[model samples]
Target chain A: MADPFLSIQHVRKSFGATTVVQDFNLDVEPGEFVSFLGPSGCGKTTVLRMVAGFEEPSAGKIVVAGKDITRLKPNQRNVGMVFQAYALFPNLTVAQNIAFGLKVAGMPKADTDRRVAEMLDIIKLPQMGDRYPYQLSGGQQQRVALARAIAPKPKLLLLDEPLSALDAKVRVSLREEIRSIQKKLGITTIFVTHDQEEALSISDRIAVMYGGKAEQVGTPFEIYNRPATKFVANFVGTLNVLEGTVTDAASGKVKVSTQEVSLKGKLNGSKSGDTLSLALRPEAISLGRQPGRDSSLSGEISEVHFLGSVIRVRVGIGGNTVSLDTFNSPATPPPAVGEKAEISFSSGDMLVLH
Target chain B: MKSGRFWAWVVFVLGAAYFFIPLIATVEFSMRMRRGAYSFDAYQIVLGDPRFQATFMYSVIAAIFTIILGVLIVVPAAYWIRLRLPQLRPVVEFITLLPLVIPAIVIVFGYIRMYGSNSPLPFLGSDTGTNSLLVIGYATLALPYMYRAVDTGLRTIDVRTLTEAAQILGAGWGTIITRIILPNVLIAVLSGAFLTFAIVIGEFTMASLLNRPAFGPYLQNIGANRAYEPAALAIIAFVITWGCMSLIQILSRFAPRSSNRPN
Candidate 1:
């Protein structure tokens, strides 16, 4: 990254004896939308707050546009933040709320009104300038908050779980709108959220955090398809793990339950008779035998879910149950629960975990 | 259910009579100064008196000053406590309640001893000093109502998030408090202000002891020497206090409805 717009270097945060964030670091390129994805109490919001100057870091520094703003007051740092609760001033009208930053900057009344109207249009709520916050819906309030944050055109934008308050449908739509707005303005942004799908769908790159540290930071494709750690793999998408013992380590032959399969150079450290966890995504496995797959496991169909576009089938082989998704075919009836089944997959798709 | 409704009305009627009968009696007696028929003669006499005008004006000024002082001191204290030092809330509540628990006579006497003419502060040595002391005493008397009103207002909004939001928007502390925090809590502050006004206007113990020519002292003096004028004054005072209460109710309708509720 050449001269990243925002750089957080070795930032650590603690409250008395409890350390929340530890040695966190990330560089966000200009106009790139990055997300800090993690579970609750995982210190994702704390890192974003540190960048917004709400919480000062215990160590290291934050440089935004070549200025070290670690110790500056939040007012001194020209950053815009949208809170999870949609912290719109209740007393002010929508236009006034959007113009709050401009007025604070000593902008003239005419310029403030023009800017407020422009922000209202950008958020697609052009006529809501006269309405108070209480009169707006949850989705509308969040849009107004987004508009308010960007009205002053700050150097960076920080969104702290801005879509978590909305319902499922609204959460999806608003997140897309937020992404589009971020792209249109080409502002460097940091969005903190615990929703994996939300992070994966909207972010250009994601920093998956755990235990107050960045476990993996990569593009969404890399984070989802090639997870760096076990936590990232399980947290990012649905995964199935099969416990298998290596029958022959040189050729990567492993036996799962009653069947034997060749993994072929996939296991580098495992020896014969050693137990290993072989992980696979649900889409990687196919029902019955397939032409291109080199590995096959025979089991009884334990469960079948008839979803609209896809059928989710779970096969039980001894004590291990592997879940896979198969397309819903109109020509063939769904598999029965007690029917004997054989699941096939490519040998290269199985991930050997230590 | 019918019997419950009947009994409820019965209890309400009893409560209404208990309160309104005495008030009706006072109003009736206040109109009897002319004799043989209801008349406004006593009201006319009392309203015309220069002493009444002087003392009432003094108390009104005192109430206004006391309200200003209370808001200046309490708003920042309550805001800071809610935003940064929430753990200290219980202790602050206890201190605010102390003014109510400790009798006014006890407080006035303590003030006299602490700031007498010979004392180092000497707040009672001059008229201006004594007036300041009286306003301070009234503010202490109104502390409980003012603090609770402002605290309740702060509760209805997300103080910490709003503060951070304003700060991040380039608003300094002054702008945040004056433009964001104060405007959001304006109704509650107004509620506290009116309650303070009512309390200060009718306060007697401190003003009487401090030798101030306030309405409360005047009402007491008239009650001791005159009959119908005192009755009229009592009705007027009741009207003023109730008017303040009504204003509080009316102003509350304009308070900004909060959108931030618990998820």
Candidate 2:
């Protein structure tokens, strides 16, 4: 969009005979926060490392701010990166670590000191400039890393699971802080993480990687609700996959268990009697029959989990079990297992997995 | 628990006795130069000798040069091996251990044969060249300790990530090594340096065969010619070695406590 700041075109990386990343491509807009979300060994970090110039792509080019940096060394790339393991110089103080790049760039001492102070302030650790990395807590250390990376005002910022080492509560808070700082600086940033929630909560867009390739790349909302592939849908969020058989090709009618549902134009090219896997989000299904819903499936209440704020129920229809969350209602008890149940949802909410 | 503690104490006392008894005997013998009197006369004589002063100074300078050369060679080699070619580790370790396995005299003879007066290098042709060769030999001898020290130091930190971090932050290889890698592992390097100093200071065979006027040869010569002064020199050498060890302990206290922590 409007002249991408970082463009990775058909990048591929292989270690000898094993290819870790293949034909990877992404164009990150200036100031846009995009996340490479995938499981471990999914090539998310490999692609990020290629962009950061740590790993050279075997094939294809990476351009940053209209300059081809595919062959450039990492130090020559002018890209800041915060590693998962803090990687701050153990011998240097927080201020010195932040000033490391500036000092290397031959910036004057006064200016370097000022920039380090500004960075410390930005990371909300204004008083930690004198402390060594070992003296800081996990969360504080990551914050300092973020500060150190951004201190040089590089063209692009890469965060490699910068919050993974922290505890759950700290992870949430630090992710939010990283997002806010990225926005404030308006530096085009690429964050790599395996956690879908983290990507969805913080990134403007997410590229879901699978099998060393990007399965889908889109805004968080689009990636979650309109996943392009089965991998994307399953990896992004929990999905209920119900096996169905198409009843009519022209009318887009399908049979799920004992119910006939109208899928309309959602099924693009399926013929009659063809088996299909229909997916639905937990939030799309209502516990019982509700008004304005076009589809209803009858099943037995198999399992019920009484969470504090919400109750999760799984209904067994035919061979498949569908899970849905409903708000806790103290006035009415949660449905019991081995009881008859009906789940309803809008027909449009169903996704025909291809 | 009582028996365990008692056994631990017994083991500690035995170890202390095993080490300190020889040193105590040497110190006692060193002071008995003046008959029927316990005086530091032997020490005064050994300290006042100009040959002792020259040889000691020469060896000290040689040790310093050896340390500089060793660090220059070992830190980068260890850093690179750990960062990129980790598979080469066992091979490099084997090469380093060769120094410990092969006798120092054998190495010195190899050096002399390779760089004699008529040889291509002719390192022994001049005093400066001979000193340089001696330092190089000492570096080779110190390789095992130096490499292991830096390698051990490299272990406590994330070498690859730290290198990449510095690289991404616009640091070149030189900057990364000098500013980042070196400082983080300074303690370990110092440990190796002190160990090398002890090894080089008392190293008699290499200095004697190389014909360098080093402290080791000086001690040997004095030990052969005189009795009291030799004991005195032995005690001084022991103090110097322990002083280096003590410095290592003190400097280690100031080393960065942790590098594996997040950030």
For residues A1-354, write the lDDT of model 1, one tens digit per residue: 389889999999999999999999999999999999999999999999999998999999999999999999999999999999999999999999999999999999999999999999999999999999988999999999999999999999999999998999999999999999999999999999999999999999999999999999999999988888888988888999889999999987899987899988878878899998888999999988999998899999999999989999999987799999888889999999999999899988877765
- On residues B164-245, what C-alpha lDDT tens digit does candidate 2 reach at each position? 9999999889988998889889999999999999988888888888888999989888999998998899889888988999
Task: Tell me how far the alpha carbon of residue B221 in candidate 1 is from the true structure, in angstroms, after superposition.
Answer: 0.5
TM-score of chain A of each: 0.97, 0.99
lDDT for each residue of candidate 2 in A119-173, tens digit (9 for 90 to 100): 9888999999999888888899899999989998999999999998999999999
Badly placed stretches (over 4 Å) of model 1 are B260-263
| B-chain TM-scores per prediction | 0.96, 0.95
| Residue A18 accuracy (lDDT) in model 2 | 96
Off by over 4 Å in 2: B1-4, B259-263
Each prediction's whole-model lDDT (CA): 0.93, 0.92
Q: Which candidate ranks first by lDDT, i.e. highest?
A: 1
Task: Show pairs that collide, candidate 1.
Answer: none
